[model samples]
Target: TDLNWPEEPIYKEYREAIKAKYQIDRLMKKRPNSRISIFAKIQAAEENLAQSQAGENNSDFDEEIPF
Candidate 1:
């Protein structure tokens, strides 16, 4: 339990390699991966969609060609 596992899956490879290199030959398969839930991902996507929609509707900026 002294190992500091990463919260992201991308870091899992590095973590596993490090564990293998330093661990006392213990299996890492039983270890749990920390990550965000699917609901969180969905909520973030929804928020992004709303922001994009709002930006599209509020396009009061100049459309002039800066050639």
Candidate 2:
């Protein structure tokens, strides 16, 4: 996984997301913003959202829940 990127769309999607996340995390360090931090804060938010929406909740970003 480190040396090669798979041809599947799932791999491509994850790769892009992780790349963007790292880029944003680096940016947040160089230019700190109180409004948002894309690292741990976002992860925490995602967890919270997941728990809160464990019911019949609808979202515009109807992404699949990871395994």
Candidate 3:
């Protein structure tokens, strides 16, 4: 039997980091106060989220596989 348990802390931290990165990216954009700049921030956040999630998923996969 397989159990799907969510790692709340890891997930929460990942989300928070993404949010903060987005905010910082926005502030660094060509027009910091523009709506279009927010899109850039979102893109940056998405990349960061993907990397973080990939790392977490890889660790989980490793834990499940036996050598």
- Prediction 3 TM-score vs. true: 0.39
Q: For candidate 2, lDDT tens digit of each residue in 1-67?
A: 4446566655657867876867866776667664456676988999998988975475545566654
Q: Per-residue lDDT tens digits of candidate 3, residues 16-60?
A: 676586785566674646777788899999999999998997786
Candidate 2 residue pairs in clash (backbone atoms < 3 Å):
none
Task: Identify the runs in model 3 with alpha carbons over 4 angstroms from their true place.
Answer: 1-33, 61-67
The candidate maximizing lDDT is 3
Note the Cα lDDT for every prediction shown: 0.67, 0.69, 0.72
* Tens-digit lDDT string for candidate 1 (1-67): 5366557664667766776787834544334322345667888999999999899778955565465
Q: Which ten-residue region of model 1 has the weakest summed lDDT?
A: 27-36
Q: List the residue pairs that clash in candidate 3.
A: none
Candidate 3, which ten residues in sequence have the lowest lDDT sum?
Answer: 1-10
Order of quality (TM-score): 3, 1, 2
lDDT preference between candidates 1 and 3, better one: 3
* Count of steric clashes across candidates, in order: 0, 0, 0
